[model samples]
Target chain A: MTRGFPVGEFQARLARAQDKLANRELAALLLTTEPEIRYFTGFLTRFWESPSRPWFLVVPAQGKPIAVIPSIGAALMAQTWVEDIRTWRAPNPTDDGASLLSDTLNEVAGNGQIGIPSGPETYVRVPQADWQRIKAATKGDIQSDGGITATLRAVKSSAEIEKIATACDIAGRAFARVPEIASEGISLAQVFRNFQGLLLDEGADWVPYLAGGAGPDGYADVISPATERPLADGDVLMLDTGAVFDGYFCDFDRNFAVRTASATARDAQARLIDAVDRAADIARPGTTALELFHAMDRVVTGGAGGSDSGRLGHGLGMQLTEGLSLIPNDHTELQPGMVITLEPGIETGPGRMMVHEENIVITEHGCRFLSPRAGAELEVMR
Target chain B: MTRGFPVGEFQARLARAQDKLANRELAALLLTTEPEIRYFTGFLTRFWESPSRPWFLVVPAQGKPIAVIPSIGAALMAQTWVEDIRTWRAPNPTDDGASLLSDTLNEVAGNGQIGIPSGPETYVRVPQADWQRIKAATKGDIQSDGGITATLRAVKSSAEIEKIATACDIAGRAFARVPEIASEGISLAQVFRNFQGLLLDEGADWVPYLAGGAGPDGYADVISPATERPLADGDVLMLDTGAVFDGYFCDFDRNFAVRTASATARDAQARLIDAVDRAADIARPGTTALELFHAMDRVVTGGAGGSDSGRLGHGLGMQLTEGLSLIPNDHTELQPGMVITLEPGIETGPGRMMVHEENIVITEHGCRFLSPRAGAELEVMR
Candidate 1:
């Protein structure tokens, strides 16, 4: 119970999930991933880092969630709003809570279909053998929830938005100090370490993801860990972070030029900013993710844009990245209270690219920035 | 790419995995988890943070692994020893690398059995729907590997052991500086942040898991994130971290007494140290994990010990925690080159507990400490 919102907030989320389940005529929804389980009940713990045990939460179509977890988590899960908790000693290869899960699902489903997430970006955390065992033991028709829970998790609540915004502000403060910490002759690895310390000092609960690269014009890839390569003049250093605050993440990055920048890098940075602005104008309730992607693409390529960096951006909350990716094929309708990142990347040269990202919350009219806007000119760290 | 061992290291690992597959008559091993994939090909990247895409590496019976991953990861994976990399635009709901994975598997296996991890402490990281689709597309017998890969991954090479030792040393240096960073009037959250900063400054690539608690006698649980509670006299504060170095983890914790310690707390600390000593004496190549557990249990409760913290310790490596739990039911025989943590816990009073942990590498004769041994008495911070 490190971070607990008002019980009413959890109740509202549970109601939303139950409504979705009812519409699908599903008897229950079985959640296994961290974000989905934490969405309904406030059972938060870093113990999920240990994959040794599987924790399960079953949301009945009508009532509250039932937690079938290891006894070690019983004390922590008891702190949550969940009441019906069944515990067992975990790491038990013979059973490993499968019987308890089956018994609980049987009691909850009552011959109706059970919905589990099996679609895009979702994985069943339970062991495959145990999942099969539980399926054989239970009597209900276990079917894919068709990403119902992910669709619900896409829209952030006010509290979640506040947490994510706080994370963004923390990372923003750290980014503002990049010039002082990153300089010539300092290895990129040392710079990465110093920046992570700054993020922690600025109030990030944890820095889960920090990836960047440094090169002459621009970096080759944005998802690389730092190397011992020292920063030199005319190098463009980009640092992207997914810093967490109270379990919510702000996915954004800032680029800094070592002493100087090339014209291509500066132009790419400006174009990325312009693309974000264009996307922001259309990022209102009822807009589809595809529409937002096209808006940004038009600005990035002067109406000839196509995909770069695989995805422009994606939904952000609870985890570093969540559902409703801002890609062309994703037609997820944006609504008020949905938090996302407007990230636009452009190729500066043949194998060199620059990416700019900003976190935002979709509003009734358009969008508001969570992370402070990057400068039009690339930051120079001399 | 960031931390590449000799290419022969990866070759040796692939050879071992292939040997395991051959023993089980599995034509190919499909790895989807971070540690497993990184183990065979040295394809290390923090891009695993985004669950949006599934990365697969197929280790055939007699050759190098084939990486069927998102196109965005192509550049980074190219840096690794992996050669045959197939890429696709991921998040493509129409396919999402399923067809590509099927084609690769079909090409590699050719009606032979494909092994996937499906036993305890393992989960398929791919989308359940996509896995089903791939299963339907491919003609191979996709069977549960039954912990085949995990067992192979449990034994570390000398190079791997060096990385773990380096991570342990980094955490040890940070723990040694705790007196300067944590004390009375500083909130536990601040202490967590400062200590994580210290870990980075010391040389940890990233600190993925840092959890602890402070209480009058001892903390109720050790898996909680830091809260805003301030340290005061007579409180026992503990910090456990899983800091990573070159993708290997050192899982250990240190205890500090604020100003003074109660007799109960002091006694509990002594018992935990004594239990660790007894367990260390028996932590050799031939002893089973259960026997090691019993050795520590005998000292903790005079032959009547029961569970206090779910597990005493577990296997530590690429992930925060892994296979081979030090529990009574786990009879996984300790072998030379296996690295594990010797964690001993005792209940000082109702709703209060203290646990001590250290990392070790099992050797041919006995075991050697990967982390500096904790002090005989809990360090007091004023």
Candidate 2:
């Protein structure tokens, strides 16, 4: 079986999903996105890159989840815990997967309501035309199930936490070798390539998201792709990576000075680290995401530097960024088994900024670090 | 500017889009997907990895596109050709860019209809709830614009083709060095890591998709991730990659024999190459995807072997797979300035198969190779 986790893990997940569906008085849950489908069946494949086809998974209120996917994925799905696998030759303009998906949903739900994720941070992977066709064919009310699914997915399993921790360790090992590959005179683009290579060499299944910037005092933004400009003395270089291991992601970054550091950059880095420490100290089973945001914002701004970045941090798991964002409006309560990132950013100058991030798993009393703790001061590369 | 292409390229694209919208009587076209937004405004950023916020671009019938996105992306979007960039602090539960996007659409569209891609191979990137909110708040009717957008994106510009060719060349260079990294004693997982590192070293901006399978005679599937199984003598290994260069992707793969090859595998490889050659010879501006599929299918099946793989080939450009698929049901005509991939898979045994792929750009007279041609014989790694 190519699926990474044991059958019990997927079974527990399905059970949780079914419980949520039952609690919401829904007959079944329709999952079309990659993360939702992979969560219940453990049917993992990189084939999702090709958008030519859409895969569907329907979880009933009482039984095991059924896979309604293309025939190309049958062999892999069979290796998972799913038993009732229905498939069709995909890219069929006449039928596609619409008929099969509709029939499957109708069989499970009959005339009852079917839940699907449709709220914030959720996207329906199936084409809108296909979704309309399915809706017209099936006799069921397709209600928004984002609240139910997000509540369940927010809590991670032990196996998932271990996988995330392993990914963090791999990234840490790669970041430790950045000094050997990055130095003055090396282009930031080349540095990105070398750093990504090091991440893969250290044991990441793949490096999906890598974005950073390099500037004299600090970077203007943290999301821009590396430019070909050569690194110079006194430049602050930041590299953030979302490396994967067994489908789990570790979202974090490390900062380094090319030859020397400005006092403003140093002070910003220290303040960001302090903010993370304060956030980590208050991250417990009962604190809300908004509360945690306030806890970090105090140290980051000190009533001066307001954050322009959307959120301070977010929940992390199957996707690079997941539920329960650390913003003022989000009231999602932190609970045990929830893995999240504490990312605090500070503005150093008019067009310069520094951001610090770390991954942690919330426990009964507090939180434990998944990623290795970064140093109090910024490290020098040359 | 951080935007990749010149203003003239984007202006041309906008002109094409406006012509399509005007012909369809659409007051404005709404784009939310990464590829769609980047295609129009050249607003390229890796921040799309985070799904916390939604980014929107609204193109009027006769003018430039307006961007209503997160404030965090204002700097990068400013670097693009888009002049009217509206900003908001994102991950805001109360109004997550909905009001801004709705207001922008209303300003341009009035009470007329707005177009959005809603057909096959198209996914709405925004949350369904937010989309509903926008539809309720705006005065325009949101209708399907997939046919228009797909038609515009199907044909590539000269600069786009060159980027894809460069990415292909980088992959070819990396594949040529496989013998030095892959051997009988090495695990397939390590081989994948080394191959991706080589692609980066060869100037590929990033490798988005790398999938393959290793078996005695041939692999059962082509989309499976590399396992830790050590390669033995007489095993056939296939590696397919989607490497990127300037947001353009090269989609192709290569097959290699570990030490010695089986007769069936060798014959299948030769036949696959022959199929590609036949398809390439017949490819021209007037041909159709169905014709190309038949051209390759005849060489692979020989009126005997039936194919289960959905499509023989698909269009490729900004995405790993896009636009028209070389399937019997699709009748999209090949046109000048269109780039596509010719992929043929042959079943060597009951459950084992080998597939070959190459990228080409359709020219005025005939098709020109964008990816370097593969050899008739399968390469041996020993």
Q: Compared with the true structure, what per-residue lDDT tens digits does model 2 show for residues A303-341?
A: 442466878999999989999889888898899999999
Write the residue-wise lDDT of candidate 1 on A1-382 in tens digits: 2366999998988898888898899999998888888888887777788888988999999888999989988888888899999999877767898999999999999799999999888899988889899999999999999778887888888888889889999999999999878999999999999999999999998898999999988898887778999999999999999998888899999888999888888888888999999898888998998888889888776655455456788898988888877778888888899999998888778898888999999888889999998878888887
Q: How large is the interface RMSD of each prediction? A: 1.3, 1.2
Local accuracy of candidate 2 as per-residue lDDT tens digits, B130-226: 8889999999999898577888889998888888889999999998988988989789889998999999999888888998888887888876678
lDDT of 1 by residue, B1-382 (tens): 2366999898777777777788899999998888888888887888898988888989898778999989898898899888899999877878889999999999999999999999877888988888899999998988898677888889999988999999999999999999988888889999999999999999999999998989888988887767898999999999999999988999999999999988888888888999999889989988998898888888776777458366677998988888799888888888999999999888878888888999999999999999999976878887
- Model 1, residue pairs in steric clash: none
Assess each prediction's global lDDT (C-alpha) against the native.
Answer: 0.88, 0.88
Candidate 1 local accuracy as lDDT? 0.88
List the candidates' TM-scores in order. Answer: 0.98, 0.98
Considering just the first chain, candidate 1 attains a TM-score of: 0.97
> Which 10-residue span in candidate 2 chain B carries the lowest summed lDDT?
B301-310
